[model samples]
Target: LSPSTGHRSIRTSSKPRPAKPCDPKSPCCRRSLTIDLDQSNNALDFVIYPRQFDIGECIGSCDTSGSSLQYTQAKNDQQKNKPHAAYNLVFLHHHGRNNNSLAATRNHRADKESSRCCSFSRTGGLELTYTTTVNGPIIKKYIPNMTVESCRCGLPATIQQV
Candidate 1:
């Protein structure tokens, strides 16, 4: 009997692979940054930087039981000792109230109410209104061969691809 020639011969092909570095400089490496302004459980302004490929722009008003505004920037700089490629700008305004009573002992109950109302008016009825815009500048030094795009917040978003 002929030695097992029944097994089919396997054939393989070798193709040359493209040469390229995996970590080419790109916006994909940059992190999204955000800034927020809030008051009495309400958001006044929320803006995202590098708006392209991200959500950006928020405007509203809130009453002040108490209010707070905060700003933060985040980005991934692959190279050590390099500053983040994004920045955030914000402007905020707070309102002040007036007091009606200054008497020391004109009916203790009435005095208490007056003080309470004064303090309450200071922050209990705060109104915050604003408009927000985002601008993103290309960090050419980071990605030499690509252009950055501008993006706005909403459905059916658009992005300029490099």
Candidate 2:
């Protein structure tokens, strides 16, 4: 994505690819994903600015070896309630045990059973102005969480059987 305008790139001849595949030890990260709204195969009739834009995607394998500390910086003016029509995020959490009891080990094994996936940690959006049909009325829409800002290895469920 463009650092200046926060807009994505226009279409190019060749698409970008990751240098190498991610492994279990690799950190979950973001990769550029350029989307062409006007691709020949697309069934839409709108002309979008930043014709080709990067929404990005998550890549890498989730580390299942040992746990580590994660710190999050809170926004000073974070909103208590998000704006209307915002995307809802579901986060899976691991229940860590302090003791290494047999039951704890069993729970840990169960936790491992639930594999983690590379997922979005933070996200933003872009405003898209398009017409429903060719020469149709122009509409401007702000899509929330349409772009991946950061990524992490996370569980996919809100509840886990311990």
Candidate 3:
């Protein structure tokens, strides 16, 4: 496929686009990146099927301050009545309960060692037909974790290894 056929450029007017309202529930999410294997500048010799394909990527902020998309119902419920700063357990424990009396206590202590990032929580594979040379035979290969299946806000070190 030619460069133009592999990727298309969008023509826009001078007018600016209206700003989209910020969504409180929107946190780190997946967006697609178009891969053009047959592009003129692409030096890949493999003849990938579907010359142009979209491989999803993670985008957006990792700040979960007002975002519910990354949290579960149980987590949200815990946030409603948070624990005391000094105590590792909840206030109810002082009365007559155990540490587990409330939801699991979070280590609110900021991790200075590493910062959170928008990363892939899950990953999939892409099966494409490729050839060693221009006239070589087509071979189907499943590249492990070649595609982004899902995304989440987490430490870069905690990203799942394919």
**Would you estimate the TM-scores of all the predictions?**
0.13, 0.50, 0.50
Best by lDDT: 2
Pull out the clashing pairs in model 3: none
Runs of candidate 2 with Cα error greater than 4 angstroms are 1-26, 65-109, 112-114, 157-162
Two-way TM-score contest, 1 vs 3, winner:
3
Identify the runs in model 3 with alpha carbons over 4 angstroms from their true place.
1-24, 64-114, 157-162
lDDT digits (tens) for residues 45-65 of candidate 2: 475664776666565556455
Kindly list the per-residue Cα lDDT of model 1 for residues 1-162, writing each as its tens digit: 235886543212111112122233321222222322322123423322222222122111121222212111111111321222221111111111122244533544543322221010000111122234344432212221122123221211122222
Residue 147 shift from truth in candidate 1, angstroms: 6.8
Model 2 residue 98 CA deviation (Å) reads 30
* Off by more than 4 A, model 1: 1-44, 48-78, 81-83, 87-130, 133-162
Ranking by TM-score: 2, 3, 1
List model 3 lDDT by residue over 1-162, tens digit each. 349588543322212122233346867666655566666455655657757655555555654464444334423443453321112112212422333332333422343212345555665555667888778778876655455556666643222323
| Per-model C-alpha RMSD | 26.3, 14.0, 17.7
Query: Would you list the clashing residue pairs of candidate 1?
Result: 64-123, 64-126
